[model samples]
Target chain A: SAVISQKPSRDICQRGTSLTIQCQVDSQVTMMFWYRQQPGQSLTLIATANQGSEATYESGFVIDKFPISRPNLTFSTLTVSNMSPEDSSIYLCSVGGSRYEQYFGPGTRLTVT
Target chain B: GQQVMQIPQYQHVQEGEDFTTYCNSSTTLSNIQWYKQRPGGHPVFLIQLVKSGEVKKQKRLTFQFGEAKKNSSLHITATQTTDVGTYFCAGEDTGGFKTIFGAGTRLFVKA
Candidate 1:
């Protein structure tokens, strides 16, 4: 299994500002993804981070809002540009492991005032 | 896009009781996985089912994949306070590697 880590466990930002969350994996992985979870809600896939390529975002999400960068198999980043109160959520990074099991990072909780 | 639905969004059980959560997918899933997330914690993989009509057990936990590959279930026997968490089921679609997560079932174990 893979061990994933995220930076800035929790942060408070002002509206219109931005926050970049980092994800690191202990081992190389072919699939890396970003997700968001609102309070008392389920996880929502944000985008897929592909090494050396642009991220594939899910519907209702755009690069201008959440730009992703994957320099290699072991690291990735997601930036919440122009933050707003609605953008406040817990951002999680995940990597596919052996079989269908996937490991997730500790998650970065962002609160935009 | 594929979607997964989980039943009984919220469940409360006394310690030592049993609890179960069901997940249904709109399309045939190539693989199904279960994850557990404690309060204020990230999701951690619990198990995965790839074969149809498969059943696997881990201590007090039991996981099942339906014959149609469109549904799955997670059962926890003799639930404890430590078992209080949210359970999510994710499905891998046929063509792409896109993984979709279910709404999740929140379990509360009252000691």
Candidate 2:
């Protein structure tokens, strides 16, 4: 089991502004992922943050919009750039756990107005 | 791109009733995992099923992986108010660590 935490548990931002969410894990992990959950919607994988390389984003996501930085094994940051009202959702950081299960952070709820 | 489909997006049941959510994947999965998320909360891992035709029991919750490894289900017996949340099923692709999540089934238990 891994202890994960995210900064800025909840934040309200104005349109066109960017917010960087940080994820810290208790131990070193090889695989880390970022997810987004819209209101009353399911979780969607935004990108996979690798320890020493560029992040692999999903189909609907682009690096210009959501830039990710993974400097080390236990830390990563996701920046939501040029935010809009549609970007209001819960952003989660998860680490791959034993037996293929992923442990999630408390989540950072973002509201773009 | 792999996709996992979950049925009955929303369920409402009285306390002590049984509830189940089904998940199906377009491609064969290496493993399946279940998660529960309360309102305004992040998802918490419940259990993982690796082998085909595997069934795991965690108290009142039972998780099953299909024989074909492309489907899974989570059944809760004698549901309670504590079970009011969204249940998600995630599948990992074969030979890869990427996981795809289902739309989730929101369970509403009336006490």
lDDT of 2 at B4: 96
Q: Provide the lowest-lDDT 10-residue window in model 1 chain A.
A: A94-103
Clash pairs for candidate 1: none
Candidate 2, pairs of clashing residues? none
The candidates' interface RMSDs, in order, read 0.7, 0.6
Task: Compose the digit string of candidate 2's lDDT tens values, residues A2-113.
Answer: 9999998999999999999999999999889999999889889999998888999998999999999999999999999999999999999999886688999999999999
Model 1 Cα lDDT, one tens digit per residue, A1-113 = 88888999999999999999999999899989999999879899999999999999999999999999999989999999999899999999999887777799999999999
Candidate 1 docks at the CAPRI level of high
Query: Hey, what RMSD does candidate 1 come out at?
Result: 0.9
DockQ of each: 0.88, 0.92
Q: How many backbone clashes does candidate 1 have?
A: 0
Candidate 2 residue B31 Cα shift, in angstroms, is 0.6
For residue B92, model 1's alpha carbon misses the true position, in angstroms, by 1.1
Q: Write the per-residue lDDT of candidate 1 for residues B1-111, one digit (tens) a residue.
A: 688999989999999999999999999999999999999999999999999999999999999999999999999999999999999999998878888999999999999
Task: Evaluate model 1 with DockQ and give the value.
Answer: 0.88
